[model samples]
Target: MMLYIIDSIRTNNFHGEQMMGKIRTLWENASRKLEHHQNNVYGVYNDYESDYRGDYSLSIAMEENNGEAFIEITSSEKYKVFQVDKTDEQGMFKTWSKIWKQEEIGLLERAYTYDFEKYGPNGEIEIHIGAV
Candidate 1:
């Protein structure tokens, strides 16, 4: 299924610890602003270039009509989804790390265009990794 999103680039070139910091900051700011929309918040990883050092754009977006005003409206292709229950306070980074590990173990090849997180009104979340 296609997802319509409104997004912004929260970083340029960053990796390792620096990248993690940027991700955290981006989420913190975005999450606060998105609180008004409740469960409509979504995060996207957009890579413009092929290399690891290339530009990495992290965006926190909301689906159309989900509430917050947006800068860009974009659409995503089909994805291979992984659902995780936020039963504990394990945090988003660890959850994402687990998802990436799954990706590494032949879950699916990343499409590299974009990958997104879908937040439920409840405590659950779905990581929608774009797949070829």
Candidate 2:
């Protein structure tokens, strides 16, 4: 089974923080109704045209690894890669494992966060939140 996934990224610093916070608020607001159990994928990518808030567009995948979640970020750019895995007891379901790692300037960081959704069967909707 494949799930529709929406991915997002956040940068460090005040401006990035503000954008991240706003993105989180948007997710929480919609999550109340968007929550599902059909299993969906999640990932992030740099929007070369993201000058405006809507410039960053989220992607939806219909075919992918089952219960697998992937997340990646490209250097010098906002490109990110992610996969969602719900079958493993330690991937998405486990918060610790779901978290990715990052290190910059000799400091450890979790560059981005990934999550999954399974909203009813055949549920199709446009991704509204996620920007970096």
Candidate 3:
């Protein structure tokens, strides 16, 4: 089994609408064998801060002759893409908003291969977000 944790920072549509909506494209890999779903973060807010943090933790149970699964994280806004490696045992990929230079809100991600012996308990990855 493999798990992909996608974290989306404070996001809003052009009309300034504030809500957490699932982006279908990101789950393209598991579309065929998607066994179950667990939406960790949905319809949330952070009025106290300038940004919001939301995550979609999808779990894919292994099947017979399965190759591999992938995790894709994207934003409707324009921003750059930076690489934030995992710095702790949590395997968190951190992102910053201010660094984005394009129309896309930057994405920082890290992936782990499932090795039950090494990674243990169905490879799980964490993502961390911060202000730009």
Candidate 4:
């Protein structure tokens, strides 16, 4: 998969920008800039210093490069997918918490590559975690 970035932030979930609303703010700003797209937005996670507990680069991106920064994932790569519950107000956060817990317990092996959240045009959402 290849994506063009609208905005990016370097952050870790613990003792980082998440609690300070940086993630939320990035998404908000990116959302506005993405209005001309096809309604499909991606939240890309990459450049992991270590793992989820470490700082990583997160970008709001789309398939059309639009002359912006971009990331590409190998075609044969694998991922552990988490479908978001659109009805849950804390759906994204809850799902991410689950991913971290699963990884910690050895239930999931993360690749620390290019993970992504796909927000589809039809309101469906899924998180694709790069897997080993």
Candidate 3 residue runs with Cα over 4 Å from true position: 1-19, 24-81, 87-96, 101-132
Per residue, candidate 1 scores C-alpha lDDT tens digits across 22-67 of 7667777766666666545677777557632457666677655543
For model 2, where is the 10-residue window of minimal lDDT? 95-104
Clashing residue pairs, candidate 3? 10-52, 77-104, 77-105, 78-103, 78-104, 78-105, 79-103, 79-104, 79-105, 98-132
Each candidate's lDDT (Cα)? 0.63, 0.36, 0.29, 0.87
Q: Is candidate 1 or candidate 2 better by lDDT?
A: 1
For TM-score, candidate 3 versus 4, the one ahead is: 4
Instruction: Look at candidate 1 and give me any clashing residue pairs.
Output: none
Which ranges in model 2 have alpha carbons more than 4 Å from their true place?
Answer: 1-14, 48-132
Candidate 4 yields a Cα-based lDDT of 0.87
The estimated TM-scores of all candidates read 0.67, 0.29, 0.20, 0.92
- lDDT at 12 for candidate 2? 31
Where does model 1 exceed 4 Å of error?
1-7, 10-17, 51-55, 65-76
Q: Return whichever of 3 and 4 wins on lDDT.
A: 4
What does the lDDT come to for candidate 3?
Answer: 0.29
Number of the top TM-score candidate:
4
> What TM-score would candidate 2 get against the native?
0.29
Deviation in Å, model 1, residue 117 alpha carbon: 0.6
